[model samples]
Target: MKLSSEQIKQKLKDAGLRVTPQRHAILEAVYTLGNHPSAEQVIDFIRVRYPGIATGTVYNVLDVMVESGLVKRVKTDKDAMRYDAIMNRHHHIYCAESDRIEDYFDEELDELLQAYFRKKKLQDFKIEDIILQIKGNFNDNSE
Candidate 1:
């Protein structure tokens, strides 16, 4: 799911956001990191290449990305905010021990959830998307 610079730039344009070096770098960092990264982690990663990058700038770019649906914030039980680049409908496997997050995609699970919600038809609510963050640890033999 790695995206090229051109793809990232196109994404920005598609989101009605101006393409800038900072924005590109921030988006690239998020995608490149793959693992959900926090603002401090992103800042550290960016600093390795662009030492002049400021914390505020990274936070601002992240806000824009979140607003434009390019990235989503994932909060851990400890309330730490992490940014994820993937926007597709899916769930998460959160390792509480390590604070690690992994994307989980199951078409059947999605169908089942949708069917259950549709059947319930909760009062006057409508369904948009379902995000399940399953928390647990994974052994080396587990997958």
Candidate 2:
């Protein structure tokens, strides 16, 4: 999902964020990387293009973008916070060995979860989001 610079500007504008070069570079780095990356990784990427950008600026930009619903922050089992560019509904598969995260989606699983929760009928509790982190080892030979 490669977004053009114009599209990135539109996204920032829509989120009520000032579209600056640093913000654009940070967003592009996250989107292009696809995989959930930590703030440090984002900073490293931005440094290549915008040499003067500070690490703290990247962190601030990510926080603002997430607060504005432009990006999502994912917490892995190991307790590392990773930022995701995709904001849609989906689950994740975390590889224990490599500490890698992969997106997972299934209509059947979604429906099952919804139905199960509806039947349970917890009192006064609302489910804001459902993100399943299936921990497993990577099967390199299978592929």
Candidate 3:
């Protein structure tokens, strides 16, 4: 999802983050990558267009984005931390063999899980959200 400068600014504002030229460029880099990218990947992407951007700034922006619900942190099976740009209610379909992650959306699944959890009603622990990472091998022929 390629985000325009105005869209990026709005997103930053919505997240209550102070927008700066550097932050705008970094966020644009994340959207340009599209696929879930790690901090190093984000830095690499930004450096091509912005050679002067500090590596620490990329990491800091991502941390703030995650905290402010602008982006999400996805941890792979190998414990590699990746950044996801999608914010809607959805899950991830992960391919362990390929280390690939795809967004999964199932309204029925969501309803069922909610019903089950509501029935259980575990004490003292409130459910903020539920994100399931279904792991399997991606069928190469599906394409």
| Ranking of all candidate structures by their lDDT, best first | 1, 3, 2
The 10-residue segment with the lowest total lDDT in model 1: 134-143
* RMSD list, candidates in order: 2.2, 2.1, 2.0
Worst 10 residues of 3 by lDDT: 134-143
C-alpha TM-scores of all predictions: 0.92, 0.91, 0.92
User: What's the alpha carbon RMSD for model 2?
Assistant: 2.1
TM-score of 2: 0.91
Q: How accurate is candidate 3 locally (lDDT)?
A: 0.88
lDDT value for model 2: 0.87
Q: What is the C-alpha lDDT profile of model 2 across 1-143, one tens digit per residue?
A: 78999999999999999989999999999998889999888888778877899878888999999999999998876665799988878899888667788988887898899999989977998988788888887787243
User: What lDDT score belongs to each candidate, Candidate 1 first?
Assistant: 0.89, 0.87, 0.88
Q: How many Å off is the CA of 2 in candidate 3? A: 1.4
Query: Which candidate's lDDT is highest?
Result: 1
lDDT of 3 by residue, 51-129 (tens): 9999888888989988998888888987769998888889999887778888898999999999999899989998999
